[model samples]
Target: MYTKDKYSLRTVLLWTRRYIYIFVLISVIPVVLYQLAGWKWLHLPWRPIGLVGTALAFISGFKNNASYGRLWEARKIYGGIVNASRLFATMVNDFITNEFTENNKTDEELFLIRKTIIMRHVAWMTSLRHALRVKKPWETSGNNTSDKEHMQSIHIQEYKYTLEEELDGYLSDEEKNYVLDKTNKQTACLNLQSKNFKELKMDGLIEDFRHMEFKNIIGELFALQGKSERIKNFPYPRQFATLNSFFVWFFILLLPFGLMHEFEEIGISLIDSLSGNEIYFFIAKNFIWLTIPFSIAISWIFITMERVGDVSENPFEGMSNDVPITTISRGIEIDIREMIGDDKTEIPNPHPEYNNTQM
Candidate 1:
């Protein structure tokens, strides 16, 4: 995501530079041409321009409010994911009995089952993050958290690398095929974890009551994954987007003519010292040129803000303003491992070396 301090004059200028030619052609050149031809040819009533500007402003305000609502909703959905992930880990650690009962399964079996479920829970978080970002689960790499050794032992590396390479080769064929494959992998991983939990219950390593408790948490995690997918796939209405574009362009087009009427009415005043007509024309020329640049600058600001809201509404896109999904997944892994009697040393710390890498 963009830093909180990213909104500044320099940032605006940088964005403007990217679309400089278009702004000049649409907003600047016409005003300059009209000024050169003399202000008389451009004259139009100020009242109509004022009315149009007010209407455009109202539309822009409504659009911004609607976009922000979507953005907030997406953030709340991810918040649910974070809570559900923690709940899953907690249920696995606390609800399952470590000791064997009359059915005769050992503590070791129970431990293995719990650990496997925990790892799979971690995998689910990672998979969901990748899914929302439209990335393959295997494409991500690095020390997202401090527990590299445990992650490697679980075969996260080999599976990820192999799958990622295969995905990269297959992406050209059809995007849906690749997405379907990844989704299957996520489901398969969750199923394996669930099977391990069920086996423990059958063997009497965990009580039937405890097994059900953990299963409920797993169900919640599945629900959260579906919610994230909904946000990623569905977007705000296209008509709302079209409306905003139309109004912004209309306002720009009508501004120069609006100023022309004011100049014509003030024309007689210029003759007391100089020709009132010439003075009025000069005022009209300067105002029109000023309006062009000012309008372009304001439009750029609005466009940039709208674009940011668009990206933030689905924060899994690997864009600058997207949620740090990889980072969150790593945090879930570290937290689960630490809770399960693993030594703190075994779990990696957060905050890998930044070096020169861009976030």
Candidate 2:
């Protein structure tokens, strides 16, 4: 969702700083114990460590791949929505006509008809985006202040206003009340649309063919809606996410124990080679502390990768890395309204980008 070329280094570091602290603790504690207490027994061979790293890499790669697929598919579904919406708007604007009607309406009345249908579709978009942004129990982005701050830096700007508030301008008092009463407001809106199209048919505003085509587009919208809902309601398998973390952490905690002795051996050889050089010996003997940074670096990489997968699995969670469906919805709204020939000044602007992300 980041529309900037990438997250700033400062932003990335700040977002990962909590996990970095854990890594620092995991790396530093064992090094201190080994150095100060002469705990030579703390040393571990590298082969088993290498094996764990290799296995963890494979699983983590799979997780990331699956997560990215979820993210990309969600985006593609919304992209479909954008196209279908424009097509629907164009069809509605052109198909409904006075040609078939015995009691023909003026062009102004027809414009109002087109406006009503398109605006209801706009309301549906509003409701859908609102539904998507609802926090699930498993979602990581919640009401925490710090994470909220970072997310808003690149999050959906439309999330600020209540959907109800936005719906007021788009729906009549009766229509608004009808929609608000429903469990799935967007689905309710679509049903209203279908009913309206049927009424338009009875009134001879649209012929049978146009009515069926409208119904077909509504069906596609339903399919897109279900696809998004499936992703939102169903989660990635928990066992894989849970066990991957445990394995990565186990390997990271064990890493310094395995590598510190190897670094110490290197230090010893350095001192032997530079014999009688007091400065070099001092530097060589203290080189074991370098393992702290090394271990921290390695741990950060694995943990960050795992976290990325975790967050990516839920694209509707309103995280900075989410799919930006709200943004896409707004773009569709802007396009559909324009295509229907709504007054340019009356239409709202596209949702503003956050840190270059159009969320």
Candidate 3:
């Protein structure tokens, strides 16, 4: 989701700060205490430490690989949604030609059908994005009434007024109000579209050509909806995740003890000649030196991998490197409106700030 020219080191560090702290605490504190206590008796076995370190390394690699796979899968699914949306727009435009030229439906009825379907498509995209992010769609909609008073105070009115004005005479007040109340505009639009399709069928306007065309478009929409749901519901395997995390933590915990056995047994004067107090200090110092930096490095890898998993699990959240759902949704709305031969101005552009960067 990040839109900058490149990823920032500052941002990466910020996201992984918590893990870094854990590594420092595990590695540094013990070493510092050892230096103060002058401990020299503490020691660990080299062979076991080496084995643990090796195992930890393997676990880190596997976790990174697994996380990347989830991220890539999420990307692919969103890509499919994008393609399907475009295809649906094309079908709608082609199938819903000036209905009067070949049918009994008036210009007004045909216009309503086209506009309603297009708007509904837009609403659906917004709703799906909200659902993915676990946010309320209505809250994000610019015309939300809870924020209406604030907008009014600042004299920063939104498009609600204009939309209402446009539909004034064509739709009843109740219908107009209903549309305005809808937070998931795209879903609402789709429902209207389905109803319109049924009406066309009942009125004998569902000629073979148009029927097939409309059916394909509806099919694409349904497919897109299913795909989004799949991404939301189906995540990476839980077993793999649990195993990888367990090994990583286990390795970190045992690392200091392993190093102590290997290095302390050397019996160098610094450790062997020390008095009781000094001996403890020496042992603790060695422990910390071995523990802190290595723990930090390993912990950093685990933390980064975990974060990658989190981002991958919800690709549509508009997070850094996550799918640009808001932009995609806006693009769909624009393309559909253009296809319906409506003025480009009728389709509101997404916020410039949001479109420019990954949230």
Candidate 4:
């Protein structure tokens, strides 16, 4: 996600430049037809266009609110994952002990078991984020030409590397093969974790009650994963999104037509005031052409708001403004590895930020 306090005006202009071109064309045409071609009948009643604009405002507000709700929900789900990862690491380090084992393993052996479980949990997170990053049919954040260009400067690690490459050191060769064979690798990773915890209990490395606690934690992870998947799988209602676009465009097209007569009246008033000055009277006579820039500015606001809602609707689409799942997962790995006293050199560093953006 963008880490800066605000996006610069230059950046916003660059991202929406294409729409500006369209708006200028849409606005200029009616003004040219009215002023130059003498099509005075082109102007529509101001009241009808005002009513349409008010309706468009309400629809746009509804869309943006719903989109923000989805984005916030996705972030909270990952927040839960972050907390659960830390708790799991602490439990593996402290709860499993030789105090209850008849055949005690060495401290080094115990450490190895703790490291394995922790590392496997990292694999689970990696799989889950990669799964979310996979593009859905309805997701359109980076699909447009302008968005694709904007995303070039932002690094999305999931797009660059294969899941197998990412899981190399985290999963054992046999476990990697088992996970790769499954369609849902995240689910497979969690199943391996569950089996490992059960075996640890069977061998008396963990108490029976502690085993139950571990199971509970696993169940929570499953719930969190399911929540994430639900958002990724189901998109914002297409009917609303589609209709919102249509309404915004309808209003933009009607704006210049409505402004024609409004500006004409303003020009007439100005001409009357400047009647004694030749130069001022000439400038005032052509004041109706001011509709072009006014229409462009107003239309830009509506179109930009529509685009904001569109991009925010899918928080996992790898856009710069979406949730930084890659960075969050890497951070969790770092924190949990440190909890287990793993060598600092062995643990991977946090993912780098690009252009004040994380992904």
Best by lDDT: 4
Model 3, residue 229: C-alpha shift (Å): 1.0
- The stretch of ten residues in a row with the least summed lDDT in candidate 3 is 151-160
Counting clashing residue pairs in each candidate, in order, gives 7, 2, 29, 0
lDDT of 1 at 211: 80
Clashing pairs in 2: 156-359, 157-359
TM-score of 4: 0.96
TM-score of model 2 vs. true structure: 0.95
Score each candidate by Cα lDDT. Answer: 0.56, 0.86, 0.58, 0.91
Runs of candidate 4 with Cα error greater than 4 angstroms are: none
Write candidate 3's Cα lDDT for 107-216 as tens digits.
67767766766666665565455556553322211332323332233221122234444344434465556656786443554566676677666556565667766766
* TM-score of candidate 1 on Cα atoms, chains taken together: 0.72
CA lDDT for candidate 1: 0.56
| lDDT of each residue in 1-359, candidate 1, tens digit only | 23344444554354336444555566655555556765456555778777877777777677767766766666677677777767776777766674655654456765665666665566555555555655332211232221223234323222344434433422233432434466455565566567767877776667877788767766776676677677667765667766766776676566555653454344434434454466565764354456566656655755565545444444554443445555556666687777776657756566231211112
Query: Candidate 3: where is the Cα deviation over 4 Å?
Result: 3-5, 98-112, 135-191, 202-206, 259-291, 350-356
* Cα lDDT, model 3, residue 229: 67
- Give candidate 2 regions above 4 Å deviation: 143-146, 152-159
- RMSD of every prediction: 8.9, 1.7, 8.4, 1.4
Instruction: Assess candidate 4 and give its lDDT.
Output: 0.91
Q: What is candidate 2's lDDT per residue for 79-155, written digit by digit as tens?
A: 89998998998898889999899999999999999999999998988888888888887766774454577777664
